[model samples]
Target chain A: MSDSPSARASRTTGTVRIVGAGLLGASIGHALRRQDVDVVLADVSPSQLRLAIDYGAGRDARDDDRPGLVVVAVPPDVTADVVQAELEAHPEAVVTDVASVKLEPFTELRRRGVDLTRYIGSHPLAGRERGGAISARADLFIGRPWVVCRDEETRAADLAVVEALALDLGAMPLEMTPQEHDRSVALTSHVPQVVASLLAARLASAEPGSLSLAGQGVRDTTRIAASAPELWVQILSANAGPVVEVLDALASDLREVSDALREPDAPGARRTIADAIRQGNEGVSLLPGKHGQNRRFEQLIVMVDDTPGQLGRLFGELGELGVNVEDLRLEHSPGAQFGLADISVAPDALRGAVEGLEARGWRIAGNTND
Target chain B: MSDSPSARASRTTGTVRIVGAGLLGASIGHALRRQDVDVVLADVSPSQLRLAIDYGAGRDARDDDRPGLVVVAVPPDVTADVVQAELEAHPEAVVTDVASVKLEPFTELRRRGVDLTRYIGSHPLAGRERGGAISARADLFIGRPWVVCRDEETRAADLAVVEALALDLGAMPLEMTPQEHDRSVALTSHVPQVVASLLAARLASAEPGSLSLAGQGVRDTTRIAASAPELWVQILSANAGPVVEVLDALASDLREVSDALREPDAPGARRTIADAIRQGNEGVSLLPGKHGQNRRFEQLIVMVDDTPGQLGRLFGELGELGVNVEDLRLEHSPGAQFGLADISVAPDALRGAVEGLEARGWRIAGNTND
Candidate 1:
């Protein structure tokens, strides 16, 4: 009830127009329409516009309506053209885009000689495996990072309006330049997607019995491989340089490991393989924990039956015990009748949490601080 | 409670002598000792043996005792030596080792001109990120696959004894040859580990701002990268041929993607990238669903606050409605105030499940079949 669109809409005021009735576009309209602000929707595809309108996203853009802000939410390939069109049509409006790639569109717009003062590029790192207006949600951006790209040419008032939009949608607004945003996403998002897809592709012609022994590690590493291929092609092609840089570095590391593995018994060969893995250990350890905190917590494993209310009962008992669960992970084997719940709690609360859960008849299988 | 070792031990009868008191060895001793079976623990390191005994994994091994089964649970580097010694010392016992690799030891024993009829090679695909008897769990192998490798010379009665041990430890026993086991694990385990570690290694030198946008996808892809480098070096080296084959194929694919991205505007560039990603989709789709069933379920997404009892209330309501949750996944942003709980249910139960939760004031954001 707290995340209801109507409740969130009261915090913002403006006439916002969305120019693409796809997932991001329709979702932005849906989130903004519930607020007191005026919203206009437009799309090249009449059917998509109709669908978004039927879903209560927004009304069709009328020629007489003067929007204060225009959000271009189209595929990366067509993002630059749409942003140019939106800016030309709404000369006074501050324009922003929700494209995943930022620098390419910015460069294209600048190449087209568009006014730079009112344009901002932003990306909200929130999406599902599916796409289209049918899958759009008003709360999709809630609590996710919405990076806003700006430079010295950006006006403070224009930047303020864009930040307000991100805030009204309950997304955290982070500021970065176009180059920085593109490079950052290349490291964190683009490279991982390509690596996952490549790893999964190797299994395409694998022996029939090879996958039967698949465990959680391989499953997690390749989970994102199920994402749409066509969408990724566009994203990867748009930011090819940065993505290729990261992939090349990883490929070099792979070559070293492969060579060392080929001659494992040779002198210093084991050391080569160990060095790469140790680098991985150091890199993964740098990731922030929940709430962007760097501190580690003790994990307590509890076994739960495959019943609907079993997890509910466990959490209820923990809540009654006044233990604050920092994070939680669930692991289950295929065909298993039960699952393991790894609950992370503050170090000081680990003993109390284990005792309380055990007293409530929950079996504590193990606990670890690493 | 059902997974308790005492309840499981009644199904088997034998004395188990474990030859190493590390994580796997100590855990086996702990599990076997809880049952009616007598467990004798030994290790090359006196302090480790003493610690395992103090932790109640098992009693110290006595020379006068005659064990029916001998488990060689040493590191991969010493697996062959330990297995040979165990087989030589206990001539009447059926011997097995819990090393991750299979072919090297089998080849080693064969090269030594030893009679291999009594030695069985097995690997239990269960482990924690950390190692040591202190981090051992009696239920570590519960519902996980424990692969047993045997040759034509192996007796049926001897194989039965090994299978019984796997079952008595609450693990599912799978049968494979030494070659098949090594090849399968190379594809599913070793290759993924290298891929994850290499991907994480790229992040080691990334810009400070790049990691702030790291999402669940990258986090999961690299989670296992934190494993000890020395342990992985031993595993990768032991299965070098098969692992190198997989990595070489993956490297070729990486090169193709990189070349295509470098000249995205070239002829058929987009097609090349799309083809690789499509192959990934096909490969990942072949994975078995939960419970080893190929059927798909409808997923319902519910937003829950970050409070302790919020999940409990949602699950409690589902329980009251008698709706069974087939699978569950939780996603939360780093600093988000709420998390999304995606609960999967049987397709036929979708309507009823949604209605039940909605009636209890739960908001249904969206649902999907994919």
Candidate 2:
């Protein structure tokens, strides 16, 4: 169901060199290599480079390799330095870096007096909670937003190369200024991380018994808090300005909520609390549904035995019923022998889907549409 | 693998009366009726009572009926009032109320000088984001912690009845004082709800493009913010003290984080930021895994096509390989034709599980143990 490597390789000719053989770097190499593109992997850490190569990410980079494009995928702190080095080493190459924060490195490079025309900054809003080449996948960027930060000085050809890189990896390329990219991520990513961490941190001193009552709600809220601190420190610090702005606004909101709750019977206190929560409902509603579409699908909950192949038979039956599943979520009671499969389908198809599954001896626990 | 209803009914033989047939009330009726126990459901709303009865929750309650157990399943505000009325109406029956906020209702009843010996307060730590009788399930309490708050004046026989109800519904019964139950839920449930709402509320006034970059991190952090504001307003207000305390601590933490980010190069700023995030990791690590076990399992990622029966085939092969899955999570790339199934197994079984699955033509993406 994916485009063939030969077909992709025919569109862009010449070697693509990737610096920093970490998760993003190796993942890009893997995706490009699958398309039969010549990808040269380079890194300061010899072991990481070798591991990435062994995992079929790319071939080892050599001194004489004159690549058409150079992807700088390194730590945020060193990204500017590496981008500068990559450009200086391969003057003819269109250089792009897949860093989380765009403005910081762009500013740093500009301050260092690096030639700006050949450099195009891009960020693929894609990654697993874990990091490193070992956890990297060739399809990591598939269908995710890959933001390209272009300036007036950026050459059209150079910008085209980065956009094509996103396209070749099956990611949607979005154009934004560096400032817009940083500010946007601060709200969507950085602030959420801080909020989650702060919420989870409260449990540090909580009683053991209290933690036992933790349900999926708190678990989901704090799931990303398990992320490595050192990596987050770097990401957070690099985008500190934008992130701090977001945090300040959130802090003010928190203060108002705390004040309202402290004096619950006061005038407008209930309104304040309810409005804050209602705002949250409005905020979350803006999020696009599956495949980045705004259309809402009805959810049907079907109980499946925890045994093997139960879900398989259920999905097979759904297929036979001609139901196209938009999304699927599986949840299990901690000690129960069965789990609930929340399958989302078109609203019109919900009745037929439920009837068909029920006919197949699958118990429909409940549905959202009802 | 579940015990038949007849077996459960034989152990506790008596009519169980449920008051206020909402989610918890109706769910209790559904579960008890399945065990062939006589269940009488009463509610203020005639239509809701009729709906519950039609859904096989229970039959209508009658004045002539004598109940062995009277379960008060009303809203928090009316819980104490209903409990008092139920006790007055059924003087011989043991009365237990399934209120999320245990302390408020318990105190309210006690303040009115109600008979304390017959009243036991309990909370089942189970619910969907949605509410009402339509969303109720027989297995809602299955494998969940049902906190039974026993006071010093409570009779052993009355306590036993509440515990028995939890057991009959396939829940794990936990004993805690009313104060302990309220504080515990404030940390595990209420605070998380507020934090999620606060985080999501930030997105309300955000730039349209900023929200488009939202990923799974923000999504999970704010998922529960979509919960009904009116319902949560009641829950939060009823237990305002403990919830306010949790929110205050979080507000202080947020302030510190904002300050730290404001001066990223300060002497202790980085340390403070990293420490807060690290504390989050510690807090989450304390959360018990499946079946209330703290032991960590190895996770193996397997790539499966987004088609019917693919997961079934995979699980069947795992079963054939004698692999017991401890937990499972599925993630899909938007617009991708495949999904990654992260299967957790016991550490000692990780090697065998991976090898077995790979041998059966499964593509193992990676494993935590690797």
If scored against the real structure, what TM-score would every candidate get?
0.97, 0.95
Candidate 1: which stretches are off by over 4 Å?
A1-12, B1-5, B8-11
Q: What lDDT would each prediction earn against the true structure? A: 0.86, 0.84
Per-residue error for B104 in candidate 2, Å, reads: 0.8
Q: Which stretches of candidate 2 lie over 4 Å from their true place?
A: A3-7, B3-7, B348-363
Q: Write the per-residue lDDT of candidate 2 for residues B294-329, one digit (tens) a residue.
A: 778888888777765576677667776767666676
i-RMS for every candidate: 1.9, 2.2
lDDT of 2 by residue, A139-245 (tens): 67876889999999888888888998998887888999999999989988998888888888888889768887888888889988888899888899999999988
Across A1-370, the per-residue lDDT of candidate 1 in tens digits comes to: 5655466445456688999989899888888877857888999999999999999999987779889899999999999999888888889999999999999999998898988788999999999767888889888888788999989988998998999988888788999988888898898889898888888888778787668788878888898898898899999999999999988888878888999999999998999999988999998888766777677889899998887678778877787877766777777766678888888888998998898898888988788852
Model 2 residue B283 distance off true place after TM-score fit, in angstroms: 1.2
- DockQ for model 1 equals 0.67
DockQ for every model, please: 0.67, 0.59
